[model samples]
Target chain A: MREAVAVFRKQILDTRKNRAVLIQFIMFPIMTIVMNSAIKVDDMPEFFYLKLFSIMYMAMAPIVSMSSIISEEKEKGTLRALMMSNVRPASYLAGVGVYDFQCCLIGTMLMSKTCGLDDGPWWRYLCVIMLGLVISIVLGASIGVLAKDQMAATSLAVPVMCLFTFLPMMAQFNDTIAKVAKFFYTQQLYLALEDINNVKIGTEGLIIIAANAIVILAFFVLAFRKEGLTNE
Target chain B: MISVTGISKSFGDKKVLDGVSFSVEDGEIFGLLGPSGAGKTTLIRVLTGQLKFEEGSAMINGKEVRKLTGADKKKFGVMMDDFGLYERLTCYQNLKVFADIYGVGDEEIATVLREVKLEDAVKKEAKKLSKGMKERLRLARALLAKPKVLFLDEPTSGLDPQTSSEIHEIIRKRKDAGTIIFLTTHNMTEAEKLCDHLVLLNEGKIVERGVPKELCLRYDHQKRIELVTTNGETISLQMDRENAKKTSSQIAEFLKEGKLSTIHSKEPNLETVFMELTGRKLEV
Candidate 1:
C-alpha cells in the first residue's frame, strides 16, 4: 500500500510538473464549457446543451490523461525503470489509474460549473462520474498500453473519444442509433446529465460498463505481465 | 549468494542463452566477461529475475529468483544497459522514489546520492543532466536499496575514464561491504581489477572461469623476452623457463660483448587471455 502511494505520488508530481498537461487539465474543460454555452441553439430542448457539454468533457478527460500516462512513460522509458522497482504491477497501475480518475472527476465538476448547469442533485452526478470515470480510464489505459508511442496513442485516442462523445448526437436521426448509443458507457453519464423524464438506464448500460472494466483491467494485467517478463 | 545452473533462454528459434551456468559466492564480486552478442546481458537479466530461463533455476539467497515475490525482489538492485530514468523527475526524486519502493528511509537517499557524487545535481531533472550524471544517478538508485545482490550490466559503458573510475570505486566499496555483485562488462581491465572470480562467456556458454591471474597464467604458458643489441638491433625470443634462463645468459653475454641493448620479459594480460579463449576481441 505504501509503495502504491509512492507510485501515485510520483505520477502526481510528474503531472504537476508538466506545464502543457496542467493547462490541458484546467483550461480545456473551461474552454469546452464556455464554447458550448456561447452557441445559441434554436428551439432546443432543455438540458440538451448541458448533456452535450458533459459528454464532451467525460470523453476528453480520460482520453487525454490516460493516453498521456502511457505514451509519455513509453517515450521517456520511465515505465522500464518503474518495472524494475519493488512495486507490484497491479499496485502501480492502480495508483496511476486512481490519479487519472481523480483528475477527470475534478475536470468534470469544473466543466459543470462553467457551463451554468442547474447542478441539481450533484451527488448523483458525482456517483455517475465516479463509475463512468473508472470505465473510461480503463478503456483509455488499454489503448495507451497497446499503442507503441505518443503519435499512435493520440491518433488512436481521438477517434475513440469522438465515437463515444458523438454517440448522442446521432440519436436525433434514428431511434435505433439512440438505443445503441445508450449501450455505450459514456451515454449512461450523458443520460444522467440530461436527466430526461422517465428515462431509465437499462441492464445493457451497466453490463457494458462492468464488462469493459473487467476486460480493461485484464488488458492492464496482461500488458504489465508481458512487460515484467520481457523488459530488462 | 547467487547460483545459476544450466540456464538457457531463446527468443523463438534464436537461442540467446545456451545452457549457461555460473555462481557467485556470498559477498564476492563476480564478473561476466564477454564481447557483445555473447549473451552477457541475457544472463544478467535471468540472474536479476527480469528474464526467465527455460531450462534452469537461479537461486538468490536460497530462494529461486524467478519465484520471488514483491518483498523478495526488494533485496535486489539492478542496473540495465538502457539506463531507464524518469526524464521529468529530478535526480533527488528519482533516487527517493526507488528508496521508498525499497522501503529505505529518507536519510539513505541522501547517503546514496552523496555516494554517487550526485549531491550537487540532486535538484536537476534527470533529462537535464548529462549522460554521465544520469548514469551516476541510475547507479545511486541501484545502491539505495542496500541490496544483498547488485546486478550491473555495462555499468561504465559510456563514461569517461575518470567517471568510470569513480563508479568502479563505489562498486569496490559495495563489494567490501559484503554485497554479492554480478557485473557484466566488455572492459577487460575492469574485470581484471574488480572481479575476484569471473566467467568468460561465448555464445551463452562458459568458455573460461577463474581469477584473472589464473586464466592469464593458464593460457600464456610461454613468456617472451625482448632483447635490444648494442648495434641498435632488437631481438625477441619465446621459450620455456629453462630455455628462457639459457636465453637470458646468452643475452647477458651479448650485452657484455656490446651486442645487446634493452631486454624485458612479457607476461600475458587479460586482453591476451580473452583473445586466446574466444579468438575475438572485447571490441568495446
Candidate 2:
C-alpha cells in the first residue's frame, strides 16, 4: 500500500511539473464544456450537447493524459527506476489508474453541469460515468505503454481520439457507421448517457464493457512484456 | 555479499554474455572493466534481475537474484546505464520518491544528500543541475536506501577529471562503510584507483580477472630501462628479469663512463594489460 501511495505521489509531482501535460488535462475538459455551451440551440433534444461532450471527455482525456504520462516516464527513463525498485507492477499501475479515473470523473461532472443535464439519483449517474471512464483510462494506459515518447504518444493519440470520439459522433449521421460503432465501448457509453435512468446498462453495454476490460488487460500485458517487464 | 556462477545471457541469437562469473565480497569494490559493447551493462542487468539469464545463477545475500522478492530489493541499489532521474522534479523531490520506496525518512534523505554533496541543491530542479551535480544527485539517490550492495554503471563516464575524481572519492567512502560495490566502467584509471578486484570483459567473455596490479604483473612484458643522458638523448634498453646480473654489469660500465643521466624500470598498468589481453585499447 505504501508502494502504491509512493507511486501516486510521484505521479502527481511529475504531472504537476509537466506543463504540457497539465495544460492538456485542463484544456480538454474545458473544451468539452465550452463546445457544449456554444452549440446550445433551441429545439435541440435536452442534454444533447452534454452527451456529446461527455463522450468526447470520456474517450480523449484519459488517453491523452495517461499515454503522455507513462511514455514521458519511459522516455526519461524514470520508469526503469521504478521497475528496478521494490514497487510491484500492480501497485504502480493502480496508482496511475486511480489518478486517471479521478480526473475523468471531474471532467464528466463538469460537462454534465455546463450542458444543464438534469440529474437523476446521483449514485446511479456517477456509477455509469465511472464505469465508462475506467475503460477509457485502461485503453489510454495501453497506448502509453506502447509509445516511445510524448511526441510518439501524441501522434498515436490523434487517430485514437478520432476513432473513439469521431466515430461515435459520426454514428449519429451514418447508419452503417452506427452499426459498426455500436460495438465500441465509447458508443455504448453514449447510449448509456442518453438514457441514464431508463437504460438497463446490461445488454450491449455490459458486453462491450466486459470485452474492453479483457482487451485492455491483454494490451497491458503484451505492451509491458515488450518493455521487458516479465522478469520482475 | 554478491555471487554469480556461469552467468550467460543472449539477445535473440547474439550471445551478449557467455560463461561470465565473479563474486564480490562484503565491503569490497569490484570493477567490471571493459570497452563499449563488452557486455558490462548486460552483466549488471542480469545480476540485478532486470534481464533474465538463460544459463546461470546470480545470488545476493544468499538468495538467487531471480527469486528475490520485494523486501529483498531493499538490500541493494542500482544506478543503471541511464542514471534515471526525474529531470522535471527538484533534487529533493527525486530523492524523496526513492526514499518513500525504501521506507526511509527525512533524516536519511538529508544524510544521503550530504554524503553526495547535494544538500545545497536540494531545491534545484534536476534538469537545471550541471552535469557533475546531476551525477552527484544520481549517486545520492542510489545511496538513499543505505544498500548493502550497490551497482554502478559508468557513473563517471562523461564527467571531467575533477568531477570524476570527486565521484571516486564518494565511492571509496562507501567502501569504507562496508558496502559491497559492483562498478562497471571503461575508465582504466578509475578501475586501478577504486577496484580491489576486477575482470576484463571482452566481447561477452571474461578475458582476464584479478587485482589491478596482479593482472598487470601477470601479463607483464619484458622490463625495460629508460635513460635520459646529459646530452639530451633518450635511450631504452630491454633487461630480461633472468639476465639482471648481466644487465647490472653493463649498467655499471655506462655509469663509470658517465654516460647515464637517469634510469627507471617501465612497469605495465591496467590499460597495458587490457590492450595485451583484448588486442584493443580500453577506450577505443
Best-fitting candidate, scored by DockQ: 2
lDDT of 2 at A11: 80
Candidate 1 wrongly placed segments (more than 4 Å): A19-24, A36-50, A74-76, A116-120, A170-180, A196-204, A207-232, B226-235, B250-264
lDDT for position B152 in model 1: 92
Q: Write model 2 residue lDDT over A91-192, tens digit each, in one string.
A: 878888898787678767776666555566345666776877788787778888888877888898879878988888999999999999988888887787
Q: Is the docking of candidate 2 incorrect, acceptable, medium or high quality?
A: medium
DockQ values, each candidate? 0.58, 0.67
Clashing residue pairs for model 2: none
| Model number with the top lDDT | 2
User: Candidate 2's residue-wise lDDT over B164-202, tens digit each?
Assistant: 988899899999999999999999999999999999999
For candidate 1 chain A, the 10 contiguous residues with the lowest summed lDDT are A223-232
Residue B281 CA error for candidate 2 (Å)?
1.6
The alpha-carbon lDDT assigned to residue A56 of candidate 2 equals 79
Model 2 residue A52 CA deviation in Å: 1.4
- Pick by TM-score: which candidate is best? 2
